[model samples]
Target: MKATRQLHDLGQSLWLDNITRTLLDDGTLARYIEEDSITGLTSNPSIFDAAISGGDAYDAGIHAKSLMGMQGEALFTELALEDLRRAADLFQPVFESTGHVDGWVSMEVSPLLAADTAGSIAAARHIHHKGRRDNLFVKIPGTPEGVPAIEEAIFLGIPINVTLLFSCAQYEAVSEAYMRGIERRLQAGLDPRVGSVASLFISRWDVASNKQLPDELHNKLGIAVGQQTYRAYRQMLASARWQKLADAGAMPQRLLWASTGTKDPDASDTLYISAFAAPETINTMPEKTLHAFADHGELHGVMDVDGGDADAVLARISAAGVDIDQLALTLQREGAEAFVKSWHHLLDGIAEKARQLAGKSDGAVLK
Candidate 1:
């Protein structure tokens, strides 16, 4: 069997962390669902920026939206929703079969609002409303400011994908927010089955800490972090708080593994995918990583629910002069800033495209 199929059979969801108009128009996304067992997808400013600028696939859409007086975030949202709605439909079967736990496509709110609780909540609602799909998750960063927004959005019953998490603490904070929202909903006589996921980023941990550690410890920090976080995830699900919510028909907000693509060329391309094999969790990989895994990825077994040697590995990493807690905060901040940068680049690219298309229609070449 293909490793992808094997992994899926083991109960870990394999999601493609990418979306582009070309992927949809060329039927690549559908093919992934049918062949590689990809049940979901995710997109952020960086992904959309690359998609919009890398090809002419979005030119006609950009041009059309420009004619309709849409630009910037508004224009991008429309284009993103169009693709997500289509992708959501493609994964509808997996979504239904899994009882709405497997197939989900995520669209992030504007990264500029990462620190604005009100704006994040409003954007999430607006996007979810515009998306018009049940399986769509409006991604909100799990920053301090975003935590309240996450809770509020969940209380409002908006399916949320909490992004930019880097540690077990961060994961716990967001998970608490999700439960609080569900608890609030139950108290207020609302449905408790709001879909959500706490996305814990991997690979970046090793990327940030590898240079400070020895050769033996290189490329190990991320998996260690993942193990530790997964341990917390298991513990949370077993907690009375979660069990009460589960008894009330609330779904456990799943723990998702993001940034699974290996950043170091010296490492195996499928390093993160092979390591993060566990049931009821998700691993969203770059398209290249997805293909590479389907081709040659190996799954030994599921992760250690007790965290294995994660604490030891982390301790060694700390003894090597890395402050794990401080690094987590720094990574979350840096991740937010990086997304903001990509968000700007994405908007600027769209504006430029609109201008170029306008010039062409007027029979003048844009310089």
Candidate 2:
């Protein structure tokens, strides 16, 4: 069997961390679902920015929207929704078969809203409603401000993918926010089966710390952090609070391993993918990483529920002067800023494309 299927059979979800019109139009996304067991997908400003600027795939859409007097964020949102809705439909079968736990497609709110709680909440609602698809998750960062917005979006029954998390504490914070949202729903006599996922980034930790560590610990920090976070995730599901919600029909907000693609050329391409192989969790991979895994990946044994030697590993790293806690905060802040940068680039790319298309027609330019 292909390693992708083997991994899927082991109960870890394999989701493509990309979306582009060509993937959909050429049936590549559907092929991944049917052949590679990719049950879900995710997109952010960076992904969209690349898609919009990298090719002619989005030029026609940009031109049409531009002609209709749409530009900037508004135009981009519509274009994103178009792709997500189609991808959502392609995954509908997996969605139905798994009873809504497996198949999902995520669309992030404007990254500029990462620190604006009210704006995050409003954008999530608007995007979720605009997509008009049940399996679409509106992504919100797990920033201090975004925590409250996550709770609100969940309570409002909008599926959420909490992004930009870099630590176990951050994961727990968003998990609590999700449960509070469910508890509120139960209080108001609403359905408690809202879907959510706490996405903890993995590879970024290693990227940030590798240079400071000894060679022995080079690519190990990210895996250790993942192990620690997985332990917390298991404990959270076993907690009395979660059990009560489970009994009340609330779904456990799943723990997702994001940024699983290896960043270092010296490391194995599937390093993060093979390391984080546990049930009821997700590993979203870049397109190159996904294809690499399918080609030659091996399933290591499942992750340790007790976190293995994660604490010990973390201790050693801390002793090496890494200041793990402070670094987590820095990574989260930097991640949010990076997304905002991508968001601006996406809008600018759209406007530039619109101008190019307009000049081709009538010597006009988009504002």
Candidate 3:
């Protein structure tokens, strides 16, 4: 069997951390789901920006929407929804098959609202409604402000993908917020089946600390962070609060490994894929990583529930003068800024497409 399926049977979900019109239109996304055992996909401003800016895949839609008098972010959201809805449909069976635990496609709120709690909440609701697919998740950052919005979105029954997390502490806070949302649902006599995933970014830790730490600790920080977070996740799931919620139909917010692609070319291609393996967790990898894993990945063993040597490894790095807590805050700030940058790129790409298509109608870039 393919290593992708091996991971699945080993209890870790392999999710595709990419989506594009071409992937959906060419049946490539479907093939990943069917053949590689990929259960879901995720998209963000950067991914969409690259897809729309790279080629003419979105040309006809740009023209169609512009012809209907829509433009800018408004126009782009429609175009994005078009792709996500189709992707959601492709995963509908998996969604149904797994009772909604798997088979999710995530669409993020405008990065412009990354710090506005109320604004993020409003945008999430609008996008959730606009998506019109049960399998679609509205991604909210795990920022301080995004926490309340996450709870509100979940309280309102919105499935969420918590992005931009960098540490075990951050993951703990987001998990608490998830439980709060479920508690509110139970209080309001509503269903407690709201699904969520606390996305802890990997690879970034390695990239961030690589230059700061001694060579002995190279590429190990990310794995250690993941181990620590996974331990917290397991503890939270087994807590009495979570058990009570689970008895009332609530699902544990699965830990998702994001930013799984290796940044340094010197590292193993499947570094994140194979190293972070744990049951009841999700690994969302870029398409390249997914293909690499399918081709040559190995599932050595799953992560230890006790976090194994995570604390000792972290202590060693700390002694090397790298403060994990301080660095986590810095990384979160930088990651939010990166999202804002990507959002602008996505909108700029949309605007450029609008102008080019208009110029084409007037004759340019195409005859």
State which candidate has the highest lDDT. Answer: 1
Worst 10 residues of 3 by lDDT: 358-367
- Kindly list the per-residue Cα lDDT of model 2 for residues 1-367, writing each as its tens digit: 9999988999989999999999999989889988899999999999999998999999889989998999998999999999999999998998999889989999999888887999999999899889999999999999999999999999999999999999999998999899999999999999998899989999999999999999999988989999999999999999999999999888889999999999999999999999999999999999999999999999879999999999999999999989999999999999999998999888888888898898887754333
What TM-score, over all chains together, does every model reach? 0.98, 0.98, 0.98
Q: List the residue pairs that clash in candidate 1.
A: none
Instruction: List, residue by residue over 232-340, the lDDT tens digit for candidate 1.
Output: 9999999998899899899999999999999999999999998999999999999999999999989878899999999999999999999999999999999999999
User: How many residue pairs clash (N, CA or C atoms closer than 3 angstroms) in each of the candidate models, in the order given?
Assistant: 0, 0, 0
The positional error of residue 324 in candidate 2, measured at the CA in angstroms, is: 0.3
**Prediction 2 TM-score vs. true:** 0.98
Worst 10 residues of 2 by lDDT: 358-367
Per-residue lDDT, model 1, residue 315, is 93
